[model samples]
Target: MAFDYKNSPTDKTFMEFDRIAAEMGDIRLVSKKELIFIPSMLQEGEQVLAFTCGVMKGKRWLVTLTDMRIIFLNKGFIFGLKQIVVDLNNVNAASGETTMFSGRISFQDGAIIHTLESVWLKTVLPFSNKLRDVIELRRGMKEEKKTFSVEGDDFVSKIERLASLTEKGFLTPEEFEMQKAKLLRE
Candidate 1:
């Protein structure tokens, strides 16, 4: 069967892929076949942010980072295609290490550890760092949301507590009013 080009990467996307590969010291490191297939894997409105090629378990693979997740793709000579996906939210503690000629990128996803090896040192270090930064940012934003929700609950509880104190006569009405005003100011 002839391959369809309907969902293929456009010139701009190709440029982006090229740019990412260039950062790894070779503009052609990512094969055209891999680039052509990338768009088909993306969800609607999802975008490829960065990608690079590396080895995993002794096989060459295309490692892609999209707006939503990381995609690991390997096209085999005889067996067709393979893919591994990890959502951004599930990624934690990404780290990279480089030796003289190559490097490794590893990250934790839940209980599993995923590692990409034999990648270019220049690319692996920055890519791992960027991945860590993104995960940390998302975690920070999530924590902020939780804090805001808790603060909302706390504010309401403070008002209720002040009203309860007033009703029990432990705090005079005037004292309750002052506390309410103080809470509101806070």
Candidate 2:
């Protein structure tokens, strides 16, 4: 059968809902901030709509801020904006892994800055628009310094942690043995 466009599981869901000034949108006139809540019908899954602006002319490109990632759907691909800077790590979940979502260009003191680490940001922006300067800033605005002093564990600590996981049967025998040997060498 020929592919039925409607029936097939498609991959197009995110949209920037900034129909403000046209839809009674809340506008922060002093700082040019604007907000409009998206209905559940727009996105059926777990998502967020974070705000980011594309500056060039007098246009607004609102960004969606969700728990996992930021989605940008730009209409004016060219002659609109070349680069985008998104806030990274603005996701407001209690304790979720960073493996889920990406693509976020947040406002910074300079341009939309990107980091070498954020994998998710890279994944989302390229697909939405072909801008190269798009940066995935993990929670740019409110980045909290890690309270834990430890950055990485020493060999002994690695082994001890491994031992604990192994004892709990979290690791297979081969994995345990490899880790054990590595620990001993250290």
Candidate 3:
């Protein structure tokens, strides 16, 4: 049940994975001490160590994102880092007070570190820990003085702000879904 992002996954395309897996499937992956994947500097089947984020008590991960796709024990890859503007609405015409949903994925150590972020109601939020991690890691490296940004890709840097709003229950599920859907359309 892979998502057909090229054509946009329909509601059914997005929801069927769970049902199919629940009937007869098992999630599986592997872990290592330190995996290293240097883009364009290595061949396939090459990675030192890696781990799945959440699995059996944090001690093991049966599967994890390696390359741009989910990987298991034996497969391997070599890939370039890319940031795609998928799911955009009015991107060619965006000005202000626009809602957006987008992701910036990095290729490192044989994995795609996905930073899923969205914006709505003048607030931006990142809904994934990986995105938060990316923000923190980047923050530590640069001197972006604002809590969130109001510039290029600034919406993505505002995960904490969005999370705070979400915790305060400011955004309704419908709002979230609508904004998310709109972003995807862009």
Candidate 4:
């Protein structure tokens, strides 16, 4: 059956949630069974990387990190559901801090920042680290690609300069053509 967020089956447990998530795409269920509450929040092509669930200020909270986004689901009985979606591409940093009884996970995406607190430190700390690592890896790859493009532009400019020098008689046409060929090959 197709997954429905508002009309999720009550009988299905965490394992069933895993099955649903798997159906969307290849995914690693990083959160322990006890941590998952709103599995319907996950979207197609999103892979779960880490998650933690606990209580803060007498309310239950679930925070999840996925390849595509970070999700926060607040479990409230009378007030219904409140969900927050933070795109992984927008996230610049993820961090966590813990004391004896409470811990906080914070996410910063440009000018916007949000934090979630839970009483479970053991779960929060590791999840935070994993989340940060994934974000950093993504950022690094993007920066590397950007740097490569910049280098390509610089190479093209240098070739143009070489051509200009050849036109001004500073370099022979043969030498300029050879250098351009070499740069293009590299």
If scored against the real structure, what TM-score would every candidate get? 0.78, 0.26, 0.17, 0.69
The most accurate candidate by TM-score is 1
Segments of candidate 3 deviating more than 4 angstroms? 1-28, 31-50, 53-127, 144-186
lDDT of 3 at 78: 45
TM-score of model 2 vs. true structure? 0.26
lDDT of 3 by residue, 102-184 (tens): 22222223233322122122221211233334434444544454433444365554544555666689976667666656654
Error of 4 at 134 (Å): 1.2
Best by lDDT: 1
After superposition, candidate 2 runs with Cα above 4 Å error: 1-46, 49-57, 76-106, 109-186
Q: Write the per-residue lDDT of candidate 2 for residues 1-186, one digit (tens) a residue.
A: 222223223322111223222122223311222222223212345333333333323444444444344443333434342223233343222111133443333233334332222224332343223222222333432233332224234555787788789889999879989978876765
C-alpha RMSD for every candidate: 5.3, 15.5, 22.5, 6.6
| lDDT on C-alpha atoms for all candidate structures | 0.80, 0.37, 0.30, 0.69
Q: For model 3, give the 10-residue run with minimal summed lDDT.
A: 86-95
Clashing pairs in 4: none
lDDT of 4 by residue, 75-169 (tens): 45545666778788899887889888767878798898776776365665677778888988898989999999999889989988998999899
lDDT: worst 10-residue window of model 4: 25-34
Model 4 global lDDT (CA atoms, 0 to 1) = 0.69
In model 4, state the lDDT of residue 155: 97
Q: Whose TM-score is higher: candidate 1's or candidate 3's?
A: 1
